[model samples]
Each structure stands twice: as structure tokens, then as C-alpha cells.
Target chain A: MIHRLIYPCEQAAKLSSRAMEQALTMPERVRLRLHLMMCERCTNFSRQIEFLRRASRKIPEVLENDAD
Target chain B: MAKYLGARFARCHETGITTRSISTMAEDDDLAQSLETHRKYLQRYAQFHLRDPSLAEDAVQDTLVAALSQRDRFQGRSQLRTWLTGILKHKVIDLMRSRDRALPPDAFSLDQDNNSAEGAFDAGGNWVDPPADWGKPDAALEASQFWRVYQECCQRMSRRDALVYSMREVMGLSSEEICKKIEITTTNLHVILFRARQSLRTCISKNWFGTQHD
Candidate 1:
């Protein structure tokens, strides 16, 4: 059996939610940051947060201009 | 006596010159300049976070109006930006509440427990093992490109999915609260989140990575 070095992806996804909210405690934040540093998957997960935020911010202009 | 003198010298060395200048015209001028700077930043920040150009504009306007009307109440405890953001946060919440009535309850999931650890790995991380040559990609793409594609992709998602994605990923709402807001069961929430993530991944890969690879 392969020993997993990190938490499962679903847990990581859940963590991504907490990470975006800036809700993770300092120690948890540090651990997540460390995990992200070593893990491309987590790094991409973090980028997803940034991507979503950027996308959400753009909605106002689209909604305002009545543009598709 | 020499050691005592040496310790005294060290203590004196550690305590550098300390001068407390009385507040002056220059200090007041600097404060005024800082306040104006903060007001500008707060407006831009409000616009970014709220995502309704008009609501963002209104929130900032209200912030400025309130700040000006209550200028005398400005204490030095917090920076002006912090205070303005606090006010703007309340305004954003008010706006969301009003908008929430017309919108369906958010339906994103937060179910990490049911997956037999192995199944979760494929969706979460194990699917794409990084190459030894892999490094940070060039960040040279115009900021607008990423956001534009991202917005288009988000629009393609279901309303509930979009709302959950925005609330969880953008606004950072907790799963429990998002479930309550979106009016979905926990199981449904997980299903929504999973599907939303999958859709976003497909959209991003096709729009972003596929082009680069081609």
C-alpha cells in the first residue's frame, strides 16, 4: 500500500474553501502553505481560488454593461 | 567594577536615542494626505469585492459620505482604509441579502469524509503528477485574459454552481453557511461543488492550457 504524504483531494478542496476565506488558523495556514509549497496540486488549487476571485470581480462590469 | 561598567554600557547601547516630537503642522498635513489616499484605495477595493459596479460605486459613495459626515468621529485606532472597508463590508452584506431573496439557495458540497480516501485522490491531486521539469509558468499573459476566460467559464456554470463557487472560492463563505444560503442539503452541496470544480477545470484547461500546448 502506498503511504499518502498529503491529505486526499477532497480534503484539499475543502481546505481550499477555508484558505480563500482567510479563515484557517495560523498553524493550519502554515501547514497548508507548506503543503502547497511541495504539492503542485495544492498550488493549482490555490490558483483556482485566485481565478474565481478575479472572475467574480469581473461580473459587475458584465452585469452593468448588459454585455454577454 | 569593569563588568558592571560593561553591562551598563551594553544597556545604554541598546537604548538608542528616543525623542517624542509634539504633533505639528507637518504631521497634520501628512495625516490629511494619508486619509485622502486611503479613501481612494477603499473605493477601488469596494468595487473589486462587491462585483456589482453600481453597488460597489454606491458602497464607496456611502463610505465617503459617512466618513465626511462623521469626520469628527475619526479616531486614530484604525487606518482609514480599515474603517472604510468595515463599513463597506456591511453594505456588501446588505446588498447580498437583498439579492439573495431573488436567487436560489447555493448548492455546493463539502463532503470529504465519504470518499474512501483513494477515490478523492484522483479528483483532488493524484490525477496530475508534476513532471520533474515543471516550474512556474510565465505570468506574462495580460491580467484581462485570465479574468476574461474565467468570467466566461463561470457564466457557463449553473446559477447554483456559480453562486456556490463564488461564495466558497471568492467570498470565502463556509460550507454550512453556503448550504443554508443556497438551500441545499449537505449531500447536494457536495455534488454541486464537485460538479462546479470539474466544470471549471475543464473550462480552464480547454481555454488556457490547451492553447498553450497547441
Candidate 2:
């Protein structure tokens, strides 16, 4: 049961994206935080996805033709 | 200043000069022309929701016409893109509602390419190819070419995933609202959102960040 608190990179990545839409359970949050502490790649993945969300909100403004 | 200009404009209308009317017509033309500039962007917006190019085009046409007719209602309080996006959202929903009735039995059938990223992970749920570091991603936000690449990556997603992802991200719908709109369970919505984000992250990292990403 204690090992369940240690999420793998894939589960950590999913939890990170899920965090954007909804709150995670306490154990799930702890698991994700623990995995992220040791995983540099998943940390980058989490940050990049948050950035993706921000960039997506700007799609309307960015899609316009500036040359026009 | 606007009131004085309106009073002068009223006199111009009462005088009925050919030059004044012609100039007014020219102003209308200019407005249409400026509105025309947004057509490509509007078409892309419609396509994101409608999923069919011809239908998207029709929706954009209707939106532009409605915008032109109701141009006075646009008080410039918000960004013009925001206002136009609001109008386009309505047009997209209306089109979707109408099309739903006439859709064939297989309208929602899955695409040939599932485009699932489930294979990206190994048996132990580790990334097959771990994510690359994207330094200063905010800088890419300012580059128009980067947007083109980003949109291309979005388009590469399967239709169902794209619809769900766009509804959540681009439309800014709440998770509950997106689940209701797409008729999916919250669990299913989370899975789709996860895949969509993962796919987009890998695509953007490869195409934009990782010069050496294989």
C-alpha cells in the first residue's frame, strides 16, 4: 500500500494534466509530488503542459495574420 | 467628440449629398474589408468545432454576415477578436445542432487512425522517449510561426480527441460542461484530456523544442 504512493512517470504525467481540470485526492497528490521530485523529465512535462494550456487560450489572437 | 460627430453625420444624412453617401458607402466597404481579414482565422475557429471544411466555411460566412449587420452593437469594449469569437461560438453551436439531425448513422464513428498515444509508455508506465526540456516556452507563444506549428499538431489529433480537447482548452468550458457537451463520463473526459495533452506536449516538444528529438 505504501508503494501505491509512489507513482510512475506515466501516472505522474496523467495526474499532472488531471490536476488542471479537477482536484486530486490527497494520496494521489502526494504520489504525484513524490514522483515529480525525483523525475526531471516528468517535471518538464508537467510545466510544459501548463504552458500549453496558457498558449491555447491565446489561439484566437495568435491565429490572425499579422501581415494583413 | 462622438456626439458632435454624430450630429454632423446626421446633417450629412439630411443634406443627402452624393459625396457624403459615397464616403459612407466607402466606410462600409472598409469595415467589410477589415472584417474580411479575420476570415481565415474564423474559418480555423469554425473548423475546430464543426470538423468539416465546407460546413466550417458556411458557419464563418454566416458569422461574418451577422457581424456586419450587427456591427453597431460591437462597442469596442473588448478585443475585436473576443467579440468575433463570441459570435462564432454561437454560429458553431447552431450549425452543430442543425447538422446533428441530418447526421448519418455512422456520424460519430471512430476515425481510421485512432491517434492514441497509449503506446508512448512502456510496460512499467515510463515514457518510451522521455519528454525533452523546452526552455522558455513563453517565447514561442509570441512567434506566429510557432502558432502555425502548434495548430498543425492539434489538427493531427483524432477528430474525437480534437473536439474534446478544443472544447475544454480553446473554448474554456468547465470539465463538467465539457463532459455534458460531449456526453462522456468524467473519468472518460479525464482520459481524453490526458491523451490530448500528452500528444500535444510530445508534438510541440519534438517540432519546436527538441532539435535532436528522434
Candidate 3:
């Protein structure tokens, strides 16, 4: 299999979410960064994932003491 | 199958029941009151995960009844809300597991087709049109009505995609745990999650950010 520096937006998006599941290999890491460096869309997509994760963590916390 | 089959619920409201022991009625009252107070949160949490409002309402109702029935086991928990969420997670998963895999004929097709996020770049993997900066998006998240729209967006997505998003984002389940719990592999989890986020971001960008300041 041939490895490249940059991945397509689709692959980059998948890798971004995969990174949340487990650690990425060195090549996968490099390709993701290289792709993001050239693709503003994936960079924004990565940030959106980060934001969603953070926001979602607080959903259950919001009404924790409301009932008592 | 109605839980309210007890005469306690059927008793005339104008004149309270004078039949059985008062202690049983008191305990039932306390449990019912607690569950009722937390109903909205339970319903919202279920809706977020299940993506079907009617199914969500049923799950919430079931969860409330289950919690009340098992109140002896849950007596004096530090955070009742968290406990309720735990019950809700199981209900959502059980409902999903029991149903036929609702994968739409072509909506949830494999990532190889990659129809959603494709065509945004050239052959060399450069962005054809860059995404706009959504600076300090927390302001929108903190909005009073943001979650309503958020759930709306999740509901708009395909069932499987929304479930993955809900399990990961709303229920805070790890992707590995989700893969082990369900039939989906880790690779499919990635693609589904990517699609979910893409769809949510686009929806929010159009609906929330477009109409708000900053």
C-alpha cells in the first residue's frame, strides 16, 4: 500500500473521529496533520468534534441539583 | 400492562382513598413525585439518544416506572439525576437492540461511497471551500434553547447515525465500549461519528449561528 502525506477530506474526517476511539499510529498521525495543514475544512471539522464532546459532557451535569 | 392499575391512582381525587394502608400510599407518592419532578430531564436525555420522540417518551415512561419500582435499591443516591441517566442509557440501548436494524436502504451505506464529505477537495486533498471560523462557539452552546435545536438536529439524522452520536456525545460512551456493545466495528464507528458531527455542525451553522450574534 502506498502512503501519502495528505489524506482526502473524507479520510481526514474519519481519522479525526477515530483518534477519539484510540491512539493513532505515527503514519496516521502524520497524514492527519499534513492533511489538516492544507485543508481548512478538516481543521474546522476537528474543532467542531472537540466542541461537541465538551458540550455533551455537561448535559447530565446541568440539572444535577435541580430536583432536590 | 398499565402500572397505574393500582386503586391508588383510580381513587377519586375529590375524596382520597380510605381503603388500604397509608404507608404504602405515602411511599408510592414519594417515589411518584420524585420521578415526576425529573421527567423532563429523562425525556430529553432519551430523546437525545433514541432520536424518535415517541420512542423516547416511552423509554422515559418505562424508566420512571422502573426507577420508582426499584426505589428501594436507589434510596438516598447522592445524585439522583445521574442515576436516572444510567437507567435511561440502558433503556435506549435495549430499545435499539430489540428493534430491527433500522438501517435505511441507502442512507447508511458504507463509507467507501463517501457521498457526504466527498467532493469538497481536489485530487491532491486541498480544500475547495474552507469552513468558516466558528469562534468561541460556547456562547451558542450556553444559550437557553440550544439543546432543543441540538436534539432537533440529531432527530433529523438517520437513526443509526444519531444513535452513534448520542451514545458517544450524549451518553459519554467510549467508542470501543460502543463497538463491543453493538454489532458495529471501530471503523464504522469512526465514519458514523464523522458523518454525525458533519451533519450537526452544518445544521447548527445554518440554524443557530446564522441567526445569532458573535
Q: Score the docking of each candidate (DockQ).
A: 0.12, 0.67, 0.45
The clash count for each model shown is 5, 0, 0
Native-to-model Cα distance after best TM-score fit, residue B17 in candidate 2, in Å: 23
lDDT of 3 by residue, B43-161 (tens): 76676566578989889877877876577788676577777878889888889766635645565567555545445555655555555677888876566577667767777777777
lDDT of 1 by residue, B37-147 (tens): 655555555554555777776776666556644555668677666666656655655565566666654332334455322243454445443212113433413345655
Identify the superior model by DockQ, candidate 2 or candidate 3.
2
Candidate 3 residue pairs in backbone clash: none
Best-to-worst TM-score order = 3, 2, 1
Docking class of 3: acceptable
Cα displacement (angstroms), candidate 3, residue A47, comes to 1.4
Q: How do these models rank on lDDT, best leading?
A: 2, 3, 1
- List the candidate 3 regions with Cα displacement exceeding 4 Å: A1-3, A34-39, A60-68, B1-29, B51-53, B97-111, B115-124, B210-214
DockQ, cand. 1: 0.12
